[model samples]
Target: MKTLLMITGAALALAANPATAQDRSNDRAGDIQFKVLGTAVLPDGEIEQVNVDIVGLPANTQTAASDNYVPTIAVEYFVTHNFSVETIAGITQHDVDAVSGLPGAELVSDAQLIPATVTAKLHFDLGDSIKPYVGAGPTYFLWVSDKPGAATIPLGVTDTDLSDEFGVALQAGVDVALGDDGFGLTLDAKRYFIGTTARWFAGDVLAIETEHNIDPWVLSAGVSYRF
Candidate 1:
């Protein structure tokens, strides 16, 4: 979060500079922007349903996934002065652990996920410097890799898999132009509604099959260059 704080500070500082907003003539249609950002991926990995639990999980079993911070890159194209399409690229890793009934037990480890998304946004022209926007779009979360946790390995578990799924996301953010030369700073937030199916196997036998709600709130702060 130290990186996030710094990004926020820089953006705020730039916004406070009176000279940065001196000109708004360059802000127009057909512009393409690219950004490098520090992002925080906060997810809720609670078990939502149990399709098959032959492993006999605890009656009140529940789980949680760890939050991760990563670097992300975003590309955006202006369809018009007030509309744009944007997408981001990044990979985040997490560990899921039992939080209740079987407290402290690790269920899955080092799950790497790539959130592939595209958003259509409506930018609200608030003034010369601040442009606030809202967006909604579809997202496909791809589970690149995952491993059985230490606790699961002893149960004769040989493999683990998390199903890739598609979902929707809502976004809101502000972009602050630093100068007319097309440099800016942005702070964006997105809420994703997504879920996945998890399976654990012992050689040829399926030990457990469960469904999970992996709703994640993605937050970002970055420097942008427009062309």
Candidate 2:
């Protein structure tokens, strides 16, 4: 009878240990991450004009650019071991020059704060060193620092009433574990598609509206510590 009692106690202790280990693993499943990101805009389509204003100039003049840069801050919340939700906030600066008309003439040189986006991502583990992810979500843009005097033309950007932009985010990267204590380095790349409208008054003479389609790609590298 004593031998049977000892055997039962050993089985209960073994069961308790696995449950405790599982609880510990669940506690460490979620992670909070921060990343510094750099982005470049790829301009394939023309900047569409919703409105236009010309003082004494011709109405046929329009401006375009080849490329632009956008840098951002990314914050991610891991919901599970291999899934997360991420939010990104960034600023973009563009130098818009009239394609055919100007000799060193800059039409618009300004910085605008891009809207923030929240994305739901699924991460894939490739062996022990590589992890890749993909996500899609909605974005909201807010325009800041519109200075009419800074441009060659007197076109005043009164406000940029940006709407809610729907976008998709794709990301892939590798995590280099530093040690067993949960310190690691991460490098990732992501692309976002965003669109908005710029509302402006041309020197109090005419009101012009412009629609901007911005597709930005982000590259980021950061360190993370898991507890």
lDDT of each: 0.88, 0.55
lDDT of 2: 0.55
Error of 2 at 156 (Å): 8.5
lDDT of 1 by residue, 88-172 (tens): 9999999999999889999999999999999987766457778877777899999999999888998999999999999988787
lDDT of 2 at 213: 62
* lDDT tens per residue, model 2, 1-227: 24423443543354345432223344435688776556555442235664554433344445563466655677788787666788877776555555543434454456355656787765554455455555556666555654442454434544333344555554445566677766677776555566655444544444555566655555666676555
Question: Which regions of candidate 2 fall more than 4 Å away from where they truly are?
Answer: 1-28, 38-45, 53-62, 65-71, 101-104, 149-151, 154-168
Which structure among the candidates has the greatest TM-score? 1
What residue runs in model 1 are displaced by over 4 Å at the alpha carbon? 1-27
Clashing pairs in 2: 51-209
Cα distance off (Å), candidate 1, residue 199: 0.4
Give model 1's TM-score versus the native structure: 0.88
Q: Each model's RMSD to truth, in Å?
A: 6.8, 13.3
